[model samples]
Target: VGVERTFPVHTPVIDEIKIITRGDVRRAKLYYLRELRGKKAKIKEKRDIRPGAKAAPAAKAAPAAPSEA
Candidate 1:
């Protein structure tokens, strides 16, 4: 896992912080997030939401076949 990573989540300066939904990460390395969008986003709720917060409802997931990395 020490593969020199630069996550955009680091050092952020934003007004609103948001967790669209909790993701059911099956794999530690989610290469899947790269090939999804719009109605195709699919992540399972696997955590307790913070106080006064609600996990966003997911739109219809696009029926996309898993792509090769």
Candidate 2:
């Protein structure tokens, strides 16, 4: 009985490396933007008097009855 193992190999190709680097940079930028947005949201919540609370609806006045001529 014999055990066989297979290992994946990557070629030292310049184009492939450049493509992989671009993908890494794009992912990093997306992650940074997401984190920044989350921090801004937290800051905004802190500034709010009631976080996650809904604003009270404005009271609407009923129309006055027309005056008889």
Q: Number of the top candidate by TM-score?
A: 1
How far residue 24's Cα lies from its native spot in candidate 2, in Å, is 38
Q: Please give the range of 10 consecutive residues that has the lowest summed lDDT in model 1.
A: 52-61
TM-score of 2: 0.16
Pairs with steric clashes in candidate 2: none
Candidate 2 regions with alpha-carbon error over 4 angstroms: 1-60
Angstrom error at residue 22, model 1: 4.5
Per lDDT, the best of the predicted structures is 1
TM-score of 1: 0.32
